[model samples]
Target: MAATAVPTPPLLQISSTQPEPGSLVVEVDGEVDAASAPELSVALEPVWAAVSTRVVLDLSRVTFLGTAGLAELLRAADRADAAGVALRLVGGTRCVDRAIEVAGLAGRLPLSPDLGHAMHR
Candidate 1:
């Protein structure tokens, strides 16, 4: 008997929107590994260029986050700082939070518990 090959699903999905005049929100779902980290970086390109006062990255739906993903996040922070844009990370899953925490970046990154808090802060 021959074994059947299983198909792999896409690693990530990213979407962006302007929730208000001065805010841009990018919602990310699915896994963010080396294969998908570049996509996240691409999705954030506009964040570095936007004139918005605030940029929010919604990680509430992410299932997994890997080292490359963390690197992209650090890149986002650096770009946001250079652009003078306020970047907020919201609703990260335990997996995502743990990865960041283990990396000892919980304090360096702007993290909020929810969208409302992120928006207000």
Candidate 2:
């Protein structure tokens, strides 16, 4: 008998909108863990490469985030900072919020309770 394989859930989904000049609003959904960190990095590469001065990461739809995800966020932030860009995280759920706080990145990275607030920041 042949064995059936189970499908793995995607690590994350990233979509972007250019609401205005010099900024990119990216919406991220689904889980971000060790298995999906590389994919997430690849997804954000183009946005970073575009030379935007500001990037907003919308995490309202992100349900799960692990250490790998947090590390990826920090790495992205560093790249943005080096490129003279600002990186902000918006609409983080409880788990995301706790993880950021626990990782001691709450202050280093701009964080807002919602997309509206993040965009304004």
Candidate 3:
């Protein structure tokens, strides 16, 4: 008899929302670092291609982040800008918030205190 193979679950979970037209809300929960940024990028590619101008990335549930993750965020922002879309991040933990500030992306990337505020901005 052959042994059964086990399936591996995705490390990141991306949920999409439609608060209004031409807008997309993506909630990501999981570690986003060098090894995982590519996965995150792949998950977001479809959303970016959908013509959603306003993109909100809720990172409240993200427990870990690294330079690669930050770079990925910047890339996403650049893509959004080129597409005439607005990208924002919301609800980060102290560590995650500090990481963004340390990377000198706080001013360049729109970040709000919470998801609600991010959506409004």
Q: Which candidate ranks first by TM-score, i.e. highest? A: 1
Q: What is the TM-score of each candidate against the true structure?
A: 0.89, 0.87, 0.86
Best by lDDT: 1
User: In angstroms, what RMSD does candidate 2 have relative to the true structure?
Assistant: 2.1
Rank ordering of all candidates by TM-score, starting from the highest: 1, 2, 3
The 10-residue segment of model 3 with minimum total lDDT is: 44-53
Could you give candidate 2's per-residue lDDT for residues 1-121 as a string of tens digits? Answer: 9999999766678788988898998898998899877888998888887856789989888888899989998898998988888888985688888888888888876579997887786
Across 20-68, the per-residue lDDT of candidate 1 in tens digits comes to 9878989999999999999998888867777559899999899998999
List ranges where model 1 is wrong by over 4 Å.
1-9
Candidate 2 vs candidate 3: the TM-score winner is 2
lDDT tens per residue, model 3, 14-81: 78887888888888888888888998899788877786568999988888878999999989888888
Better of 1 and 2 by lDDT: 1
Which model, 1 or 3, shows the larger lDDT? 1
User: Model 3 scores what on Cα lDDT?
Assistant: 0.83
RMSD over all Cα atoms, model 3: 2.7
